[model samples]
Structure formats: C-alpha cells, structure tokens
Target: MTYCVGMMLDAGLVFMSDTRTNAGLDNISTFKKMTSWETPGERAITLLSSGNLATTQAVVSLLEERPHAHGERDPSILGVPSMFQAARLVADTLREVIAQHDAAGQQADSAFGATLILGGQIKGGPPRLFMIYPEGNFIEASSDTPFFQIGETKYGRPILVRAYDPKMSFEAAIKLLLVSFDSTVKANLSVGAPFDFHFYRKDSLQLDTTGRIDADNPYLQLISQGWGDALKNALESLPDFALE
Candidate 1:
C-alpha cells in the first residue's frame, strides 16, 4: 500500500508518493513509487503509482523501454504532441501490460492490478493530470476536481477538500500534501515514509524541484506535530453542545 497525490494548480503541478509496500506484518519493504520522463524544453511527464508493485513496475519498464526498444527508437513519451496523447499512450501501455499478465490465474487479478496518477506538460499544451485506473481508462483533473489521490486515500481526502486553493504558492501546496500524507501514514501501517516529491511550473517544460523526504526530516516532523496540535486546538475551541 502507498499514498500518492497529484495536484493541478494555476501555478503548475505537484506530486508526492510514499515508498512503502507491505505483504504481511513481517514482510515489508521500501521501493520508489514514482517515475518520470523529461525532455528538457520539449516536455516533462511523471507517474505516481499504487496497488501491486509488480504490475506497476512492469508498466513503467515498458514505457521506459520505448525510447530504446529494438534498433528503432519510437516516438515515445518525449515525442508525444500533447498531454492528452501522452495520457492515452500511458493508458494503452498500462492496459497492454495488465492483459499480458492477467493470464496467471485468479491470483493475477489481485496481484497484477495497479492504479496510477499521470501528470505533466507537452510543449504545446497546458499542464494536465489524470488518474488512471487498473482497467486502463482515466479521468482528467478539472476545476471541479483539481487533484487526484491514490491508495490509502480516504484518510487524507477531507483536508484537501477543505484547504486546497488554486492560487496557492508552490510552497503552500507542498505543505498541504505533506499534511495529507502524514494523516494517512498515521492511520495506516501499510503506508510509511521517505516520500518522493516533484513540482513542475506550467510551461516551464522542465522539472522545477524534486527530492526525497525521510521520516527524520525536520520539516516533515514539524508538519506532523503541528497538524496534530492544530486539530486538538480546533476541537477544544468549537462551541460545546448542550442537551435541552
């Protein structure tokens, strides 16, 4: 299990993903859940994944191989003309990978299923975000739905609904996502830390910033403690209910 989020903002796009994957109480490991492709000035694409690790890894490997597959180099993601086409290519690739592994019997359905969040910019189009399902179909984020969260989502969705702002600075957006990820991590053991994050300013056609945030990172620790204190204070400040 993991917690990954991608936000579509007026300033640009932001993404974050936790690195934990658990098979049982004693069987747990950390693996990167984010992958990205960039072409300097032409385009920048990112993928945040959840669900079966094997399936997700296979999908990413396929996409990455496109640029070097065989003796011929295909158009690949770097050559896609628009964000919309990029999303379609990703969906098609995901679907094909699943179909290839789905024949492994009943276990395949559960073990080979995966979900992804795709976002970025293609030179000619605006930045875009999409939540792609295990079935390969996806929905784009819009004004009404400006962000997408996958895996262990229920725990952190409320804050996003109440606090998201289209015009907030890139710093504020990262802070908000950290709070959300912290909430999910506390509620679910399947999700842990050493999160990976990235930001892309619209039309920049390059990744603006990217880094790994570990559990001991001071800023992350502050956000966790601060959010808890703020919640308790809010609860205590609310008007008391009186029974008539």
Candidate 2:
C-alpha cells in the first residue's frame, strides 16, 4: 500500500507520495513511488503511482523507453503537445502494461492493476493534473475536484477536505499535504514514509523544487506532535456527552 496526492492550486501544483510497499508483516520495503520528467522551458511532468509495483514500474519504464526505442511511433510524455495528450499517453501505457501482465487485461481488480496521478505543464497549455486508472481511463482535476489521491486515501482525505484552499500559497499547500500524510502513516502500517515531493510553479516549465522527507525529519516531528496536541485540545474543549 501507499499514499500519493496531487493538488491543483492557483499558484501551481504540489505532489507527494510515500515509499513503502509490503507483502506481509515481515516483508516490508521502501521504493519511491514518484517519477518526473522535465525539459526546461518546455514541460515538467510528475507521476505518483499506487497499487501493483511491477505494473506501475513497467508503465513508467515504457513511457521512458518509447522515445529511444527504434521506430517508436508513439509520442513520449515529453513530446506531447499538451498536458491532455501527455495524460492520454500515460493512461494508454498503463493499460498496455497491465494487459501484458494479466491475461484478463486491464481489469481494475486484476492483480496487475495500478493507479497513477499525472500532473504538470506542457509549453503551450496551463498546468494540469490527472488521475489515471488501470483501465486506461482518467479524470482531470477541476474546480469541483481540485485534488487527486491514490492508495490508502481514506485516512488523510478529511484534512484536505476541511482545510484546502485553492488560493493558498505553495508553502501552506506543502504543510497541508504533510499533515495529511502524517495522519495516513499513523493509521496504516503499510503506508510508512520517507515521502518524496515535487513543487512546480505554473508556466515555469521546469520543476521548481523536489525533495524527500524522512521519518526522522525535525519538521515532520513538529507537525505530527503539534497536530495531535491541537486535536486533543479541540476535543476536550467540546461539551461532554451525558448518558441519560
């Protein structure tokens, strides 16, 4: 299991994903679930993946390999003319990979299934974000749905719902995502982090910032402890229920 989020903001886009994958209690490992491609002054693209690791990796590999493969007719994510076309290329690659692994082919419930969050900007269009499913279908972020989450999403969604502001600064957006991730890591054993994050400023056509947040990071520690204390204080301040 993993947790990945991509948010569309007026300022730009913010993405984060955890690095944990586990087969069982004794067989847990860390693998980065985030990948990005950048052609400065042209485009900047990032993908966050969840579900079958093999399927996700293969999808990414194929996308990366297409441009270099001899006689490759398909447009690479980097060469796509618009963010929408880039998303289509990713969705198609995801379905192609899943079909290769599963005889059933592109079934959402198939063992080979994976889901992806694709977000970034191409030279001629505004920054865009998409959630692509195993079945080669996707939905873009809109004013009505300003974010996308894939994998272990339940534990962290409330924070995003209550607190997200489209107008917020990029700094505030990152802090919000970290708190959401902290909540998820605490609730799910399969979702431990050393999270990876990317921040893209709209029209920059280049990745503005990217980094990893480890389990022992001081700011993570502060947010985790501070949020807990604040939540407890809020609960305690509420009127107590009395059984009649």
TM-score for model 2? Answer: 0.94
CA displacement after TM-score superposition, residue 60 of candidate 2 (Å): 0.8
Cα RMSD to native, each candidate?
1.5, 2.1
Give the alpha carbon lDDT tens digit for every residue of 35-80 in model 2.
9999999999999999999989898888889777877787988788
Off by over 4 Å in 2: 104-108, 236-244
TM-score of each: 0.95, 0.94
- The C-alpha local distance difference test score for the whole of candidate 1 amounts to 0.90
> Each prediction's Cα lDDT score?
0.90, 0.93
Highest lDDT among the candidates is held by which one? Answer: 2
* Top TM-score hit: 1
lDDT of 2: 0.93
Instruction: In angstroms, give how far residue 234 of model 2 lies from its true place.
Output: 3.4
